[model samples]
Target: MSNERLRIALARSGHTAASLAQQVGTDPKTIERWVNKGRVPRLRNAHAVARVLGVEVRHLWPTLNGRSEVSGPVGSDLVAVYRQRSDVPIETWKTMFDQATESVDIMVYAALFLHEQISDWNGLLRSRARAGVRIRILIGDPACDAVRTRGEEEAFGHGIESRCRLAHMHYRPLLGVDGVDIALQATTLYNSVYRADGEMYVNTHIYGMNAYGNPLFHLHRMTDNGLFDAHAASVDAVWCTARPLTGEIPDGSD
Candidate 1:
């Protein structure tokens, strides 16, 4: 079968076989064979193509062994580690979002701090969307058992659910904006992920401590199946099962 993923990614990235081949230092016929004849490129070529396309190699070739593509030591993708989530400078968050040119994705339970702390959070998202950056947000479903359990675990009682609802309200303005999407997920998140292009911040969720008190990891994607890709896969999985926002919060029954 043809590599539809490659074909679609090329179209979305506005790259024809000739242009992609020119960048990757290959003949256009090779690219056409990779897409039309389903032939995988060499490891280096695959990595180069994925980098130029701004995507993970595994994303274009799902069955490929991502671990085999690593060229450096483990944890090479780690950029930094913050002792506490709150220890991450606000400016860092701003820079990440501001520098994103391709995509911004978030997965959280009640990241109320983002809206409360980031200056003009909604406006920033709108601006990114207007710039043609795709944004996908997956927040916890306020009425889901996962939220309730997490609230109790965090000693917040029903406050976690309230924050989820409030977060929904804060994101309401971007509901129908082009290139922006909001979804509600019921998964038990172990780490909240905030990604802008190839870099991301991962906030670890402790059993009894509030998220702000937990550790955070800053990772930049370096290989096809590295630390960054692992978290990104989790985010994608949750996003797949999430329900899209409809400009109205779901009642408990939902």
Candidate 2:
């Protein structure tokens, strides 16, 4: 679609119209015409533009993609793509975290409180790191060192030193790393995880709807590229200015 508003969005997002056009394999004048003339290109071109912009193809066609289609499982309700969280099984979380290859961003108000379950998660991180996954952790100030120390101390006690080490981890606040391609935000009050793949997300919230009062909400497989991209943007905005945690070992002893 050739809309000035879309052009503005692209400009504000650190992308130039010409670069975007080149990425989508379109001429600069074509992009200029679309922005200045409010012209809607063919569906295929629109999709190509959306892909280049890292947004959903339907962003240019809200009527079709905005509507909520069958998402999530039985029980939990579908609340618009940008809002609802997917309360999936713990196993699924592990699987998804394990599969994360390119980037991993997590924002948590509380550190991983399940230190007893540290081995599996630590192993996952180490394995991912070894495989070259860019991993980042964001935790509230009050919980940052407590979590790091707790996890490491626990690991030491169990003779699992390397697995629990946070030397390679980076800690910052929610607003410090906005614009990151893929990220997750975890809040204790309402535990939610936003796992992004491209612009789509497999948002899983572990909150109120667990099997036996466990802190798992419901699971939603949202394919809305626009909404997912928007969420990722929001997280990045918050992460951009948030505090950065330095000195991995807390005591500066490595």
Candidate maximizing lDDT:
1
How many pairs in model 2 have backbone atoms within 3 A of each other, for residues 3 or more apart or on separate chains, i.e. clashes? 20
Q: Tell me how far candidate 2 lies from the true structure as C-alpha RMSD in angstroms.
A: 12.4
244, model 2: CA deviation in Å? 2.1
- In terms of TM-score, how similar is model 2 to the real structure? 0.39
- Model 2, 1-254: lDDT tens per residue? 35544664475346676887878788888877777776666777888876555444444333343453343342122222433322333443454455555666565433343233444555566667677766655444333343344334334321222222332243222223333222222222223233423222333333223212233322222344444444555556656645555433232233
What RMSD, rounded to one decimal, does every model reach?
A: 9.7, 12.4
Model 1: residues >4 Å from true position, as ranges? 1-73
Best by TM-score: 1
lDDT of each candidate versus the true structure: 0.85, 0.45
lDDT of 1: 0.85
Counted clashes in each candidate structure: 0, 20
lDDT of 1 by residue, 145-212 (tens): 99999999989998889899988999988888999999999999999999998778999998989999
